[model samples]
Target chain A: MDKYLNSQIAKIDTSGIRKVFDLASKIKDPVNLSIGEPDFGFIPDVAKSLHEAIDSKCYKYTNTWGLSELRVAVAAKLKMTKKSDVLPEEVLITAGASGALDLLFRVITEPRDEIIIFDPYFMFYHELPRMLGANVIVLPTTKEFWPDIEALKKNINKKTKAVIINSPNNPTGAVYPERIIKDIIDVLDPYDTLLVSDEVYEDFIYDVGHVSPLCFYENTILVSSFSKNLALTGQRVGYAAGSRGVLMAMAKLQQYTYVCAPHLAQVAALQNLNLDISNYVSEYKERRDLIYDMLKDTFEIQKPEGAFYIYPKVGDGEKVALKSIEKDLIVVPGQVFSKSNEYLRISYAAPKDVLIKGANILKEVADELR
Target chain B: MDKYLNSQIAKIDTSGIRKVFDLASKIKDPVNLSIGEPDFGFIPDVAKSLHEAIDSKCYKYTNTWGLSELRVAVAAKLKMTKKSDVLPEEVLITAGASGALDLLFRVITEPRDEIIIFDPYFMFYHELPRMLGANVIVLPTTKEFWPDIEALKKNINKKTKAVIINSPNNPTGAVYPERIIKDIIDVLDPYDTLLVSDEVYEDFIYDVGHVSPLCFYENTILVSSFSKNLALTGQRVGYAAGSRGVLMAMAKLQQYTYVCAPHLAQVAALQNLNLDISNYVSEYKERRDLIYDMLKDTFEIQKPEGAFYIYPKVGDGEKVALKSIEKDLIVVPGQVFSKSNEYLRISYAAPKDVLIKGANILKEVADELR
Candidate 1:
């Protein structure tokens, strides 16, 4: 039989995160923190909304852009947080942050177009750009896990189509502060480069205010989902909002891709957005604090200002990860995110007891490695 | 802003079916015979299964292929169909048939590959192939909607990668007879062509036994969804089953596209598949009978062997479509399905009352045109 796969399939590796996740599933009693999903259940009202939607026959296909009411709600939410003056026309609901990211890269990049990403970044971001036939330029971040603005400025050139920013950062969970966000935006401001900001963890920020590049730049496409904030990861509802011009382009791409986000999920997200989700925010913050305290006392770990992860420096991060696996505690090695192999990302999104058990196992593994 | 959109975005025109649909949505008390969706509500037990899934925490991401249980169920279902001996590894649950179709096009066709389609086919099939940078070789079926095997054989060249067959076809409601299907397969048997069978309406066939190309061809990729069969369109649960090779290639492509199908939907589909769905199938068969009787009495329409649509010759399909719109009835013109503008396709998936109302409006329009 002819090789049925496309060339792009061979070029991109299966996600390292997914590989570890699959491994964790087979091991009995494994405490998994490998995948980048919030461990909380879907908020009660969100689940109720979904059940109501299914009963209402909201399971049919929605408009290709998405459900209008959901788009309007997303626009309203964006307006409040980032001062983004986008209307519903400028929002495109997608499968998830992953879907939005893939669409953005595919629509914006032609073959050989250059997209810049900060290293020690979301691994999928790097993989997506390459899969779309674009060169991914990685500008390494500073020691504190913020984008190196100087490196970003130097990397900007005419071929640069977009620069992807994730805050709070995946794997590391380092939220970029406002001044640094503005600095990065200013550097790209001179060029006609689009800024792709993934703020899926926006509601999970701890000490710092979530800074949106959309606030400083009109050319930004802000991608987010209810997965993290409302604990609806399996629902797979997300949106990308930006200038009407950019969104219209993305919408056309989406029409050719998956048509629209799943309708039932869209209704659930619409309700999730409208309802008060302060309880989830507070609960996650408590979990983050507890995990941070444990890591700080035992290991050299940077306290994340946001997101559900803490990157702790353990000697030979991969070896530590393997040791944790032996102890039935699963964590991601730093090399999955970047070249750094001294640190591992430990998720605090699990229940308090699961986190406690995993943390104790991690401490034992670290001591054995030392 | 340097036109942040890729050149390919400009190449796609929004589906022509959508334009008529938009106009239909505005018509007060309109009889919508335009949408291709099954108009029945989800089976009560299926809805209950979904509700239970949501109440449980099936809201986390499933395996990228789908939930293992769902895959196993799908594989068993495929086995029952006797299309091909497929395993769980040879099945992938997708968001909908739309997602599966898009992924199939993406993985199978590289730039400049050729895909064959029967003219007067499902409109989306034409659009999707074009979107993938593949040139479509359209062979017009006979006036009675049977495959033109000679023309199909003539179109096969070194570049021809796949042929799309929508049995119990959309727009025309034509089901290829067993003899015709075997003839089409004979034409493709010698060539290195992949038969892409879209059997979304497999369960709705009135008189004919549905025979998927997979039954004869080992290289077939079968795409289907529970949307029509279980009336769960909005739930967005579908699957592609075929040879292990084709499924693996699609899985790699899906990993880059949307990752996986929604978790809760997969759970619902899994549970629903276990239940006897004879009642849903029987209800659709009744609706199909009512439409066939009405169309034969009211206008010059061929009795569709299967599916929910009937293509009736109306003087200048576009003009009849406009007249139907004026009378608050919505139907897709044949021009949307192909370049031919001589017929209109009306869906009979609605309740008998609604279908009768639409048929009356269409009859009036046809009489006026005559």
Candidate 2:
């Protein structure tokens, strides 16, 4: 039955995150730090606005790009933070940051074009380009998950179509510092490369706030979601801000793909774009610090500057991860996100007590391994 | 700036349907017959169910393949119509039927793979496979818009990866009879091509009821949306039922694309699966008959068998369509759907009074052209 299917899709493995997602659902009483969903509910006002939007039934398919107001809202939010002015014409709202990547890559990539992805990035980034038959060049970040500028310089060339950088990154939780980001941009100085930034975790920063690639690069697409801040991960709604030419192409691809992102979500987003979420950021930071304290002495763990995850190096990660699961603590092994199994990505998006219980299991496994 | 982007995406003309959609919003008191949107709103029970789902805060992301119960619901719906039993595993709910097609062809198409598309079909189908650099073989149907068995058989070959057939079709509004469908199936007897049926208008058929490709072919992928039937065009939820292998692959692709259809839409669908829309279909039929009566004597017109559109032979369709708009009427030129300028598609999906006003204006324009 599958004989006539696209061979590349067969070669691309299903995401390991989904594997853990399904496994966590089936297992009983596991402290799940596997999935990256926020451990919070929707903000009060945002929830109210969404219900009102639904009641109105005004939430039909928006313009192929998005509702005019929502696109303007996205631009307004970006313009307030970025160094350069952002425009509605330069934005395309999407199903999620995931959907943005799907449309972006599909519009930009010809088969065999090279997309250089930083190693240990989001799992979908690993698969989405490959599904398009594009060659993915995985560049490993140095210690502390920093983008290695020299390595990036060596890789950038006439063939490099795009570079995917995730700040406040998934699993690793390493927020790319603005200085190094500028350095990486310098590396792409001689060639034309689209800088694609996944900034979905922008609201969860513990130290330096999120720096969009828009601040440094003209040819950049900044994609982020309300999934983390608004606690609507299950609601797949996000947006991409980039050059008008690229965004227009993405919007065209979107018409043939998802049609438009959920209209209700887009409306709610417009209503709550300014609602405060600093408390959520602070809470995530406290959890990040707590986990760092617990694992810092026993295991080599990077203290996350932002986002809700901490990547801890552990020998034989698969064995340790499986062993940790036996203790009713769910942690996704790093090998799932990379070519090697030297570390495990532990999400601190869980609540405090759950975080403590999961951290204790990690310490227990680390002590035994040491 | 687009030098590195896929050339095919540049070639994708954004749907002219959207142009009409936007224009309708602005034109003051134009008897609009341009868009194919269902004139009816969702029934009270379905609306209530949707609101209840939203208020309950259960509208989170469903399983990537979709909520299991929703898949089961879709399967059961298919079972009632098909000769053979269908299973939930063969069903993958999507953002819309648009999302279903996007994922399906992406997984099945290699570059330059020949996908047979019946001419005068949905605008998206023309652009989708071509976006992947897949060769689109356009087969013009007979004058009555039936799938010509000889033309179809001549196009069948080893390179043919799929055949896209839309029944109760858009624009042309031709619903294939079961005998012609069987003959088309016979043409595929020698090849390994997947039969893809877009049945989004299944419920709106006037004369002969909808015949799913599933009944005759095991390799068929049947995709339909709740948009037309439920009047939830903006809600972005639909399903694809096919062989387990293809459905599974589609689900994997969806995990990175739209992720899942809106959870609220799926929940509402579960509550209202038995809710009838036959009255809505009957209304469309009446409107269809009304428009046909007005134009039948003035021009060469094929009475629509099903669906809410009439393709009338009007000389210089673009010129007539433009002049019709000046008379405070809206009509889409046939050239938007095909090369020919002789026929313009008139949607009777408008209200009775609106259809009357629009049809009179159409007659005025056509009388001069004739």
Candidate 3:
């Protein structure tokens, strides 16, 4: 019966992260940092709002586009944050940032269409377009993980349907500065290729405020989720803001796909629209400093300005990760996020003590491997 | 930008039911019978369980397969209810039954694969497979909405990848008896066509017990949801039970698609697994009787055995539905669910007074059209 499985699905293996997760589960009290979601939970106010929503019987299906009030609120929030005039119709509440990308890809991709992504990307950026029958063109980033504007310029062609930009990118934690974002957008503008900006880490930037391509590119679909910022990863609620043409197409695809974002999560988001995350940002910033300072001398690495991960240049990352795991620490290897296997992605989203212990173990492993 | 839309998504329009939903929302005091979900909300115990889950901080991602204990509970429940020796590994919790079908079709369908469905079927049974690039073969049912076993035999061929069975069906609400289910399974046994049974309405039968194809067929993927039975429609928690090979394939697809079912809903489902739904069932049963009894005199109709709907054989269903809506009543035309436009599908899952008013308005529209 396995022969009946779709060729596309059967061709892909389980994600590299899942393999590490499985290994972590088997080890006892491993200082796990392979997980992508926030280590904390939602604030009490968010839970209270959800409780009220349940009491008020908000468990029925909302509009396929999502609750009208929630959409309005999301539009307002996006407008203030992205500094773009986002209308309610331009915002679509999705199951999560992952769900948003799935819908966006389904709407835009045709067989053999080319989608360009920077190397050291979120893994799905590569897998999803391929599964949808699109060819993924991997453009290498600089050693510091900034988008290579020249590489992006050279990659565009008639078949290039879209280019993905993940600010505060996973694995590398390279938050694209405004100047880099503008340069990338300028390169793709003549081709009118769609820009998909994944900004789920928008709230966690430490050095500078976040920059979104939505403000500069009309063809951009900006995808973000509350999963990280609100610690609601399991709630599966996110939104996509884009031009009405593409967003409407996404909403229609969403009806048959996700139906709508989870009702409880949407309601929680509505109430916490004004949530202050400076405390979380500060906490993670301190951890980022702690881990980077602890490992800087031992391993050659770039200082991360956003998100909670630090990638250290270690030879045979999977080997180092495996060796580190033997000492009760879990971290993801860079090959999972890129074609290269020379670095380790250690998440600083864990507690300070866990980060401290995990960093020392990773450092020891790197030294032993050298 | 619409020119860039995927050809598959661009080819389809908004569903017929959605048009009526939009129309219904505009009118004041509309007696809406167009909803596909249970009108009531979740039971109190379910809410209490969710509250506890939130308080206990179940706000992180569960395993992509779903929460392990919930999967175990669901497998155990299926063993007793489905009367099959179901194993925990054979179950994959999904965002909803819709998500299950989406993943299932993605796993099984290749371009131009043929999927068979009985006419007067759920709208998605036609749309989802087509979106996956499969050709949908709609076989007509009897007047009472029973699968014509002879038609089943005729439709099977090398290209036929699967057959969908929705007992206690949507729109028509015909619950297949055990004998018919066994006969359908026998007809497709030779070709080994996969059976995708949507049993979301299993808990709503008024007269007879539910008979799942899973009890008799090993190649069946039984899809059911807590939406209708537990009144968690917006919660989007459901599961698929099938042979481990297919379920595993679906699980693999789920990692990139839905990621996982909403965590809070899974927690709620786990806590309320043994919820008593007899009261809600009996309430809907009475409303079903009331609508059928009232409308039988004016129009030729089949009494729905389950699933909160009745299809009256009205001429030009859309015209009747439109005329009825002017009187501030809402119902769906048959064209949404089937190729034919000769019937009206009225949901009886409303307050008794609303059902009474909607039924009378429907009768008047049918008479005026006649």
Candidate 4:
């Protein structure tokens, strides 16, 4: 053996979330909050659409950018959100949000390019930038888990190629306020840095409106996927949208990588994007609300403005996770997200009954730990 | 906008095959043969397995490596070929052969690492190595489209990190004879260069026994996907088996890419692997024979020994491609594969009726040119 592992690949530690999940899976009746996946089955109509698409022989390689119709649908959705003027040409559908992120990393970051990310971030953001041989500079978020404008401004430097922001943030469901988003953009605008916004959880915000970097920055690259909103995690369809220059670059990179997302999944996503999902979104909102109430009353947790998660403060994050495992409850330790060891992110995207059962079990586990 | 695209992203050219297909798609009733996809549908049992798996909620993210069971199944299958002493731990199920190849390129090639690839190769093997910021040195194949050991030896340099060989070669369908494969391995043995064997069409050989480089070389990295042999192109499941070192490196790279293949597809592929597909293979062999007979007898073209493709000499490849398009017959110009403007690679993997219809149309087109 050459003993010559690529430095970039060697730098990405195996995901701690996966490590804990592996251990949790070995335990009987473990409640899995470590996984950020939405627990809802894919929307009935969406599932039907996939079944129909598969049977219709849409099971061939799609365009490297994605199915034209699906791209058009994504463009239309973006238009509705009043983001930048997006056409099908400006969208590159990917395997998932993770895949989109990977493409963005490959397109934007050369070795030694600096990427700024907020602390207590989606851990993958940190790992991905590093894997691309980019220097990841972490700016700590405010106490509210929102983007800290001053901290972000301080981190900007000439070598910074991009800033990654996950609004309706994972691990902590802190939806960055518009003012904060604008301020962050203002700082990035003068620096020639691309703002990479991960809005996979854009549809899951509770009280606050989801703000997209696409609205304020021409250089912004938006990454989102159907994994969360459509419960299509298994289908692995998502997209990256940006200025034509960035998207074109990413599209070329995608061609050499995986060619395109699965055609059947693209068709299903196209169908779902066009159809009315108001009922599902509303139901999800209800679940989020119900889970919020239960968690606030039973455990000391910070309520999130958007996304289906709560970052609950518990002493010794790993210890709390281990204690939860004893009760067959699965939750990710905050240490997985950052060096912080006092919080755990709990997902509320499961069905109401499962949430209720899980909440009760979590409450009992917390009490025993205290 | 920053004018600096990532060096890695800028190096990849858009897929030549996909570009040809895009142009071909515009023509009505075209007898398309440019795509490398299998012409057969999923085996009935595989389709049934997929349907059942999807309905049973197997549609979730598998482990980042893959579903453990699928890896085990793949390991057992590799044992039959006696190619490598591959264990489940040495397999990482991917979205497709393309996905596996992407992972390999990312993990094995650092900036400026030189990779050797045969000319008239699968365009991706050339494109992907370049995309990783690696130097690609093309060693032209022998006159018969087989590996030229002397040419490979001349190209091997200290900077060479890997050499790619695609047996049952694309565009040419010339399977490197066993002795040729061994000679190529012996050439690489002294350099500690990684041998990447892409055997996507492993089972499609007409008469010759498949010889894996892993059979003789410990450094060989074998890449195969279910798209061809199992007729599951859209499902996008594949596996890479190699020395534990190479597999580990690929696994790390995969972690930062798409994370893992879709869980449901893995389950479907697992079932498909165990199912008897002798009928499917037999049918493909029959189609290959039929196409070979038609081309050799009617068009006076040389017959290919393996893979469902035949590259016949044509006058001015691009002109012939355009002429075929005018006649509603789509065949890939050899220029797309290389500098050769004298041949067109036609796929014979279509349904018997379609292939017959296409062959007659092709003969008419060829006669017009004559």
Candidate No. with top lDDT: 3
Decide which is better by TM-score, 2 or 3: 3
Predicted structure 1: clash tally: 2
Q: List the residue pairs that clash in candidate 2.
A: A60-B234, A61-B234, A234-B61
TM-score leader: 3
lDDT of each residue in A210-274, candidate 4, tens digit only? 88878678888899998887777877789998778888887777776777887767887888875
Worst 10 residues of 3 chain B by lDDT: B10-19
For each candidate, what's the DockQ? 0.61, 0.61, 0.75, 0.53
Candidate 2 lDDT, B1-370, residue by residue in tens: 4675688787787555555545656678778787677766556777788778766776457778888988888788788866646698888988889988988988898988999887677777888888777888888888888877788888889899899998888878898888888888888866857999999888888887778779788878899888778877777888898878888888877877787887778887788876878788888888888888988898888778887788988877878877786787888888777757777888887889998888888878777766
- Top DockQ hit: 3
List TM-score (chain A only) for every prediction: 0.95, 0.96, 0.97, 0.93
RMSD of 3: 1.3
List, residue by residue over A1-370, the lDDT tens digit for candidate 2. Answer: 3776788787567655555556566677788887678766667777787778767775467877888888888788787877657788888888888888888888888778888888787878888888777788988898989887877888788778899999888878998877888887888766858889899888888877677779678888888887777766666788888788888888878877888887777887888887888888788889999889988987787788888889988887777887887777889988788887888998988888998999888888777777
Q: What CAPRI grade goes to candidate 1?
A: medium
**Sort by TM-score, best first: what order?**
3, 2, 1, 4
Q: Model 4 off-target regions past 4 Å?
A: A1-4, A15-25, A274-300, A350-370, B1-4, B15-25, B297-302, B351-370
DockQ of 2: 0.61
Candidate 4: clashing pairs of residues: A31-A330, A33-A330, A205-A306, A206-A306, B95-B236
Q: Candidate 1 lDDT, tens digit per residue, B1-370?
A: 3388787666666666666767777888888888778666667877888889888888887777888888888888888875568888889889788788877887777888888998788766777778667898888888778778889888887788888999888877889888887887888878857888899988878787888887788888899988777777766779998877767767776776687888877877888775676676677678777777876765667778887888887768878888889999888888888878888888877888898898787778777877
List the lowest-lDDT window of 10 residues for candidate 1 chain A.
Answer: A14-23
Model 3 error, position B357 (Å) = 0.6
